[model samples]
Target: MRASVKRRTKTQQDVQPETADVAEDVSDRIRATLAKAISEGALKPGSKILEDAIADHFGVSRTVVRGALGILEHDHLLERKRNRGSFVAAPSIEQAKELFEARRTMERLILELALGRASDADCDRLNAIIDREDAIHHGTDEKAKAELSGEFHIELARISGNGVLTELLEKVVARLALVMTLYEHEHHDDCGTDHHRAILDAVREKDLKRALHLMDEHLADVEGRVRLTQDHGDRHTFEAMLASFSPQ
Candidate 1:
């Protein structure tokens, strides 16, 4: 009788379902999928994400979709208007500047901390990521490479062993990816392989100052390459007609 009671108790404990916990997991899965799509450029900037459509596609209720989208909106990956539906965010010029500025500041501090705390195992993991990146780089799809590029910066914060810092850097990198998707004229590789390799070498050598300097230059070089003045206007018949009146 005692053994049977113990067995029954264990079984009940194992089978128990936390309804709230399950709902949260569903929402998290939805948010991660959508965020990946946006970061990979599969979902274009300013694209509308209809809750009904998402709910249908994911086989979830509208409530679940809403919860997921709320997280994305908080992360600045989506914007929810009062009357209008949620749309993928398109960072404006000023927002782009602020994003990059914040990224540089946060990432520099992260690297400084990582320099102090990263163990041999942590550094090895970073190297492995770069190796995977190299394999992806040689592949045909630039979009995959682009996603990895944003991840590299976030990965550094993870190596720092600071959860709060990692979360902050993750959001910063996501916004930066959106900025690049909107404003970059041509999509090249996200980060220069040589640049990444050099930074890793510095970290391994325990040259914190050199690592920091390289990171600063690498970021500045990337930002300088972006022409913030590039027009993002849609092609229209009116513009085409007006262009025909040019003196040329």
Candidate 2:
């Protein structure tokens, strides 16, 4: 009887850490899914996140959902109220202006540095991303295309060979996605591939001045299209929005 009890106790103890790991895995998966949804515009700014419904959808406890949302809140992707739960962050027009200004500064530096160091291989990699963008347009994945749009900028930062700049640009780019969510109009979600190709070609030809000018023009074009003084709302529940992303 004593031996049997000891074996059962050990089994329960072994299961405890495994259970905690599973909970953490659930939290991470939820965080990534929510982040991607926000970036892709499926989860628009100011949308309320129903914790209970999300918990139910993922078959996890409310505690797990809270953990995931807490991570997003830390990233500024979500905001929590004292009694009202979490909602997607909605930046004001002032905040949007600030983000774009900062992006312009960072991207100029990024492009300048990348131009100085770009090898033939780097140009090839950038062209591949553009090719992928073209393919995404012909396919049926708007979200992928939007994500690639953001990635193109980040990739430029990466090729600049500045890790600190890359890190800063990543945060700025993420916040800019939220700005786009609040202000972008129909058919204005991308920084046209042609603009990207033009910049890449200038870099390949070692035309520093022209590349810098094109970068400025491209960012100006993007900022010009956003409606800074407009109302923003979307009529989709959190679960319903996420459900659309799920496979049949």
Candidate 3:
């Protein structure tokens, strides 16, 4: 009986790590899918994040969904209310201004670094990123296209060869998605590649002054779209938000 008990205990121990690993992996998938949906405007700001809905959709436990939601909360992508639940973050107008201010400050340094360090090939890669996003059909690949709206700046940051800067800017842009979704008026798309192309054009010509001016203006334009307060005209159900979500 002692030998049998030892064997059973060892089997359970061996299975525990594998079970934990699978749960963590599923949590990551759940997190990534929801993040992209949020960034793409499929998941509107201030929508309650239903842990049960997500768990049911992903065929995972509420524990796993909470793990994902916790990471999003850390990033300010989700806000947890006392006894209520998590909801998508809806930044106030003041918070929106601060976010843009920080973005302007960071992007200036990024453009400066990019101008000094970016190679001709880096310019081409930037062009490719822009073109690829442009090619996506508005109806067919709308999800991918919208999610990629802010990627041009990220690509440039990568060219600057500063991993830390790139990572920080990514977080900032993700949070900005919340701002844009909550505050912008209907029919306003801020990340139009027109601004991206113009900025890259200046960078390629090594015109740092022009590049900085254009980037500042671009950031300004996006910030200008925010109203102090507005009805959330596009909020969707939790079931709808998870409907198109696929594991990534």
Candidate 4:
């Protein structure tokens, strides 16, 4: 009987790590799912986030869902309104402008840093990201194109070798994704690729001034594509808003 009890104890010990891992997996999945919702426009600006619905959809408890929502709220993707529950964040035209301006500044700094510090392998990685962006541009997937464009910028930030700056850039990029969904006027081809290539070339040549200028021009082009206005007519309904929260 004692041997059987010992065997049971061993089994419980072996299962503890797996249980902890499963808990972590759930938390990560929640974050990723909500992030995708925000990115894809399923969670539109000002749409209510039903905790119970998310819990049911993901087959997790509300506690886990709340934790996930809390993280997104911290990230500025979700906002809690007094007595109105959590809703997807809505950026006004002025807000969007401010966000883009901040993005421009951060990205230019990241480019300057990257030019100074990027290793050969980092450059290669950036090139690979560019290739992926190009492929997405040529492909028929519009959503993929938008996502890849954002990722290209994030990859550049990563190559800059500044963790704090990278984190800031990631937040800016997430906000940009929302802006692109709401305000993009045209599906311009090449997506500032020549500018990226120019920046990369300048970096490879170790020309910091030229790289910074190229980055400025690229950001200007991006900002020029947005047509922000007060008219959010079609995106104002609950169902319409909820649809926006999900992936496109």
* lDDT, residue 26, candidate 1: 86
Clashing pairs in 2: none
| Stretches > 4 Å off in candidate 3 | 1-6, 137-141, 229-248
lDDT of 1 by residue, 74-124 (tens): 999999988898988878778989988998898789889888888888888
What's the CA RMSD of model 2 in angstroms?
A: 4.8
TM-score of each: 0.83, 0.81, 0.84, 0.82
In Å, residue 156's CA in model 4 sits off its true spot by 1.5
- Looking at candidate 1, what is the lDDT of residue 168? 87
lDDT tens digits, residues 1-248, model 2? 99999999999999999999999998999998888888877787777888998898888999999999998998788999889989988777788899899989999999999999999999999999888887887778776776774777888899999999998888777878888766765455345778899999999998999999999998988887677874532322334466666888
Q: Model 1 residue 105 lDDT?
A: 92
- Per-residue alpha-carbon lDDT of candidate 4 for residues 131-202, written as tens digits (9 for 90 to 100): 787777788986675456467678888888899999998887787766766677664867887777778888
- Identify the runs in model 2 with alpha carbons over 4 angstroms from their true place: 1-14, 138-141, 230-248
Compared with the true structure, all predictions reach lDDT values of: 0.79, 0.83, 0.82, 0.78
Ranking by TM-score: 3, 1, 4, 2
Model 2: how far residue 76 lies from native, Å = 1.7
Which has the higher lDDT value, candidate number 1 or candidate number 2? Answer: 2
Runs of candidate 4 with Cα error greater than 4 angstroms are 1-21, 232-248
Give per-residue lDDT, candidate 2, residue 204.
98
Candidate 3, residue 170: CA error in Å?
1.3
